[model samples]
Target: MGMSVGPSGGGGGRRRGGSRAPMAEINVTPFVDVMLVLLIIFMVTAPLLVAGVPIDLPDSRANALEQEKEPVQISLDAEGQAFIDDAQVSMDDLPAQLEALRKQRGEDNGDAPQVMLRADRSLDYGKVMLVMGELNRAGLNRVSLVTTGSSDRP
Candidate 1:
């Protein structure tokens, strides 16, 4: 005599007629986890990437200027010492160095390159002005004074 088994009575839950198909849907859980980890790493490192010579910038309420290209950075410390990018430069050599930089930027024909001046808050206004004068004499007229935002004030 032949006997029939019910649906739940089972041959290890296998169907009698057909085999199961492979899963076709993608598993996004691992991809999302990796992406989140990469995002966290970037968030932690982004600020450190904006490295430059440290200087306490003066506070200002002036609106920030729009920039099209990377500007030449000039920094003056509280001791009135000057720096072009990160290298120390003497006041005597500043103008000549700036002129060389201008020429390198191909500003000789037209459209002068911008110079961003960052001066310590403790520096004298005259010292900053002198640097600005040197920059102007070098024909780098497109100058922007870098200052910290005044949002921290009450």
Candidate 2:
């Protein structure tokens, strides 16, 4: 007598018969991780990109002013030395440089460019006034004093 062992089909129907197809679903976990790292790097380096002369500014409770254009930056360090946007300029040459800048910006059309004055807190009042005097002589009358915001505020 012949004895039957069992069903002997290919793969025994336990697995798919054909080769597996390529995976249609994409893995986004790695892509998201890379993007997050790039964002963090930019956040850390953004503030350092602002290049300017450093000086100790006094804190004020006054609100910031609205600006229509990029203002000129004039800084005075603790030694009473003046700088025009990070360039060390002698007090005697301040007017000529300012005048040249004013003319180059075409301020004669009546739209005066604003000037922001930054003076160290330790500087004497007279020194600050002297810079202001130079600004006025250069016909830059619309001036604003730059001060840091008070840290005690909520």
Tens-digit per-residue lDDT, 10-90, candidate 1: 546566555776679999999999999999999999998763677888788787888878888899998999998889999
Flag regions of model 1 displaced more than 4 Å: 1-22, 107-109, 151-154
Please, what are the lDDT tens digits per residue for candidate 2 over residues 106-147?
456765579899999999999999989988888888889999
Which of the numbered candidates is closest to the native, going by highest TM-score?
1
lDDT (Cα, 0-100) at 76 in candidate 1: 96
How high is the lDDT of residue 59 in model 1?
82
TM-score of each: 0.76, 0.74
In order, candidate lDDTs are: 0.86, 0.84
- What lDDT score goes with residue 121 in model 2? 98
Candidate 1 clashes: the total is 0
Q: How far in Å is the alpha carbon of 15 misplaced in model 2?
A: 23
